[model samples]
Target: MKYLVREKMFSIGDDFWIEDEHGNKAFYVDGKVLRLRETLVVQDPHGRELAVIHKKVISVRDAMTVERDGEVLVTVRKKLFTPFHDSYRAELASGDELEIRGDIIAKEYDIEYGDERLARISRKWFRLRDTYAIHVDRDDADPAMLIAIAVCVDRLVEHEHEKHEHEREQHER
Candidate 1:
């Protein structure tokens, strides 16, 4: 079944928290809408299959985090994408984590960000400074991937500051 995906992009914000169904509170992304899936297979904490609802869920109202330098930076809204058998990969930088999303993961790749090598490819990568958001070809990326990349662009200034600080430290030594 096909569903209509909303346009309220979700990303890491200052205040974010996620509460589980059991009233347990966790860090969730704020200022973003969650994309829900059409079918939800809710399982109990004990791993027992609980309920399956045939619903039209376009996004998941959940929070996702990528760690960098032992710091939790951005909180991403979880939107479950239907796995397309054919799709290219796109890499994004969020503070210190380089999130790559696609059908096939490209590990050990270099991200050329604003004339600087940002991060090494993997499930995660170190976010580099001095990165700029280049115009990515729409044909080359999916909507969700584009959203992730746009978030990275938002953090480019922060990365630049970090890069400058590191350079200054080197000169001091």
Candidate 2:
């Protein structure tokens, strides 16, 4: 199923509404305020938390963890020095590793487990800025997990771009 993730504007903390293809609000991503590190909680319409995503504090590479019920489901880390495209490595608690590759700047990417494509995230399908669609193969992946992964990936990519821009400004000064 494809869901639309629309980011909120003019908010101190990041907030998003995940909508179904019919434009019905399906899930809500609440970015916790006043945290040392970035953190977000995904909840159902009824307000029950489905998953929690937070940046890893002590990782050498940019990393984030997804958890449900205090159990880590997966850890996603950015792959440095990938040629031509952005890459990420995800380690699942089940010992299954996945690779994510695509144009992160354009928000077009796929999550793959070996040869199988588990999920696809893209903004090309929508005309609205800051809005993207996440398509998860329900037969191959859990929708909630994939959505959380997309959220983490989006934040990481944005953070990296900002970091680069800051460094560039420093160099120009």
Q: Which stretches of candidate 2 lie over 4 Å from their true place?
A: 7-12
Given candidate 2, what's the lDDT at residue 74?
Answer: 93
Cα-based lDDT at residue 12, candidate 1: 27
Instruction: Please report, in order, the local distance difference test score of every candidate based on alpha carbons.
Output: 0.31, 0.84
Which portions of model 1 show Cα errors greater than 4 Å?
A: 1-142
Predict model 2's lDDT versus the native: 0.84
Candidate 1 lDDT tens digits, 17-74: 2223234432222342243422222233343432222221232432333333334334
TM-score of each: 0.22, 0.92
